[model samples]
Target chain A: MSALRLIARDLRLAWTGGGLWLPILFFLAVAILYPFAVGPDAKLLRATGGAMLWIAALLAALLPIERLIRPDWESGFLDQLAVRGWADEAVAALKIAAHWLSFGPPLLLATLVGAALFDLDGDMAGTLLGGLAIATPALAALSVTIAALTARAGGGAAGLMLLPLAIPVLIFGAGSLGPNSVGAMPLLAAVSLGLTVLAPFAAGAAMRALRD
Target chain B: MEQRQAEPAPDAVVIDRLACLRGGRLVFERLDWRIARGTLGLLTGPNGAGKSTLLRIIAGLLRPAAGSIMVEGRVALADERRALDPLPTLRQGLRFWAAMDAQPATATDRVLESLGLAPLADVPVRMLSTGQTKRAVVARALQSGADIMLLDEPMNGLDKASAALMAAALAAQVRAGTTLVLASHIPIGIDPTTTLDMAI
Candidate 1:
């Protein structure tokens, strides 16, 4: 019951706090800019669009990183919940789930616009959608972990820490869209699942460390 | 009030040889104290003293470098930070904690009334004055129905009437068998049964 309420609170905060539109807007901005940057050649746009979308999705996930855990930490919400018999791990897991819910689906919908803008064919579009579906949770997990790690120090350290760790996800995610890259999809799924499982523990440890 | 399983000890908290270290400096060492249930226990100290640190240790939010604390009941804390969603209405913010604490729906109203914040229920938390925000944090702690509340500077920003209200509400909690470990720099109205002076 408390778990659901926690998720509800997070969703409410995300929607009402005005960051819900940020990632979507940023995603579309990248989508709109990519074609202009590459010139309006349909073949070039289609060739590079999937990779561009992957980059956009990754960057979109990064947009809200600062707001993720810092506010709750500063406001003493985390301490209050701890006193209420909540484990840091459980809180972190719930946050990751909530973060993904707030981030993943909206970006997925925005991807449709990006896909259309890029004039992606059926096969490429399907690959793009599938790759994102498997990848965004991992992206969400990464963002949350980075948020916890740098919740105190601010955004500079977060970018420095997150970008390096995110290389694997980015590699496999973009690789899946390459022609005849049958093995890349499973690798992406594998890496993503591993991150999703480990992120809660990492983020939880960061919060606990912060308490000292 | 929600019923709790009967505790064996008359004391809600027992601190033995407690020590705290922050930033590689010893904040306090070998501190010993007992906070009896159904009484107000005051933690009074000068600035840079460890009153807030002791409360955090008692609340289990911070680890003590040495010694152990045995807390006998559910604990709640209302510190300098409001610990609430600033965007939500005061009532909505309190209701979230109430729900988390597993208190009934009516608990929010009752707590607000006790804290003299009923009129501010519909106001957004960010719009509240300093004292109102302090009262709201107290309201959140009180709504939890915890047997022990560790409040850091509960009366910090209150004016005379609001301070009186806060004192009255805390006294009422003591009368109802709730234990409070309060850290305040100012002398408060309620007569604390025991006072731990950390400055020494």
Candidate 2:
């Protein structure tokens, strides 16, 4: 019940901060623009549908994460939340899950619509959503861990530093629908979950560092 | 003054051979401290005496490099993850962790008319001022049903009036057989019952 309350509190904070809209705009706009920058030809755009959709997702899913944990860390609530008796893994899961609910699903839908507009293959849409379903939690968990690691939140450069770490998700999420089998997508998912569980320990330690 | 037995004497907290090093800087080296039953002990030292670090370790919120803490006749923090016992997690109710700093926690309110916080019963703990926060911390120590309370600087950041309230609350707790190992510089108004100079 308290976990839900905390999650609800996070959602309320996210909503007031327009966390949803900024990413929504960025996701949609970038989805619309990247193909044109690469090439104006519709044929090239059509050919690149799967890649474009996944890339847009990776970009969109990641943009808000830079700001994801700043408030909680700054507020001193992260350590307090840890001490609240919920298992560390459970707390980590709830934070990542809430983050995904607010940011991931909307971006997925936006990407699906973008894919349809671009005449991307139907199976690739399935891949986009499925891969994202597998990967969004991973993205959130990894971001939380990295943010916890850096401790000094709100650094714009930190997000960029963390982006390369998600390349596997970008790779598999974009290519999982390929003619050849994509075995590594699930592997990417596993790594993300592993990070989620382990990140809390680091986050707890980082918080000790922060307290001083 | 002879037969003063209100609440039973709780167990002591034993911290032995505790050492901690952060980034190669030794905070403490083989420090040993023992907090007895029902005594209000103060932890004092200069700026870097590692008072908060020691408190965190005692609270089972952090781990010591080489040492152990036992409380209530049991290993207090055998595993960094475990406490005196996994003090039952707050399932649903009002709680006063640091989060309340921005969330408005009250430390006291009269009966008959309650605010939007029945969950915060047993004595208000949300919407509290600094002294009130300390008082609430003590109230929580009482409510926690824990025999021993580990308070860090129980008097810092509190005004004189709030300090009196806190002192009274501490007195009440100590009188109830609740031991307090507090970290503070300013007198928390309790007759300096006991003091442990961390600088030593």
Candidate 3:
């Protein structure tokens, strides 16, 4: 019951955050504008669409995590949860799951809209969505750790810290669409899968750090 | 004044030798204290005295920089990481943290009333008038069911009525045979069985 209460509180805060629309707008605006800036040749748009979609996807994935964690920290909810018979790992998992639910699927569908706008064909669209589906969990995992680690520093700075670390997700997400190299897409997917599994450790460490 | 006793309780909290560094300052060195369980104890001291520091050290929240402590016959501050994965028993340890110092005003009113908070519990913990927060904390501690209670400034925010309630809770817990150790600037109970004044 206690664990559920903590997670529900986080989900409610995320749902109520007014800025959720801003990221979607930013994603859409960036996706559409980049093509025009680089010259709107259909062929070139097709060529760069995967990369642009992935970049937008990265920002979208990265954006909500800090927001998700900030309210909890500011409210001192995290520390209270820790004291309330909750292992930090369980707490981290709940936050990550909540992050994925709120951001992952919606962001994937948005990517679909962007890909269509960029004129990405059927096969590429499937791969883009597939990669995103696999990658979004990993993104939440990353956010969980970074948010936990930098929670003391406050929210905005934590988001900035995560911006640079998004390189791998960006690489693999876009790489999923570019070419048919046997290992590339799988490796990317595998990394996200791996990160999805591994982030709990980092998140738990962050929880312990905050307690100390 | 004679020390009060609830039941036949443990006779001592033995700190063999204690040490801790808080925020880079060495708060204590080889400090020793032996207080029996179920006995009223007071640690009186002026401001900046290592009173809270001593509580943390005893509670195992802060590791002694050196030496050791055995509370009622167990390593109260044992390093759980190295000692063993499964503790023999955790029932003996009871820790209740404050509302993390939030204000007394409340965003939601229901949580206040449900906890019998009514008008006062509605406020954020920080915004809560001292006595109101005290009542809430004591109410929460009662619900928590921890065997050992470590409270910091339990009476800092209470009125006469609430302070009486605080005294009632402590007496009731002692009646129910719960070990109570609290630190406070203001006195809630008319009589404390054992008062260890840190105000030396």
Rank ordering of all candidates by DockQ, starting from the highest: 1, 2, 3
Arrange candidates by lDDT, highest first: which order? 1, 3, 2
Instruction: Estimate, for each residue in B1-200, the C-alpha lDDT of model 2 and write its tens digit.
Output: 34424545433767788988766788897777767687776778876788867877776656788877775521111111111101222211224331322222432221101212233344432334444444433443344445566666666666776566567767876787667777776666776456667783
Q: Candidates 1 and 3: which is better by DockQ?
A: 1
CAPRI category for model 3? incorrect
Off by over 4 Å in 3: A19-25, A65-76, A155-160, B1-7, B11-14, B34-39, B70-116, B120-134
Ranking by TM-score, best first?
1, 3, 2
After superposition, candidate 2 runs with Cα above 4 Å error = A1-6, A35-40, A66-75, A81-87, A152-157, A177-212, B1-10, B29-31, B65-67, B73-146
TM-score, per-candidate, Cα-based: 0.97, 0.72, 0.77
Tell me, per candidate, how large a share of the native contacts it keeps: 0.94, 0.03, 0.00
| Candidate 3 lDDT, B1-200, residue by residue in tens | 13434445555466666776778887667666666665555666676667766666666545678887775522111111111101111111111121212212231232233334565432334454445544554454554445555566666656666666567667776666555666666665746666656543
- Deviation in Å, model 1, residue B115 alpha carbon: 1.8
Question: What shift in Å separates residue B154 of candidate 3 from its native position after superposition?
Answer: 1.7
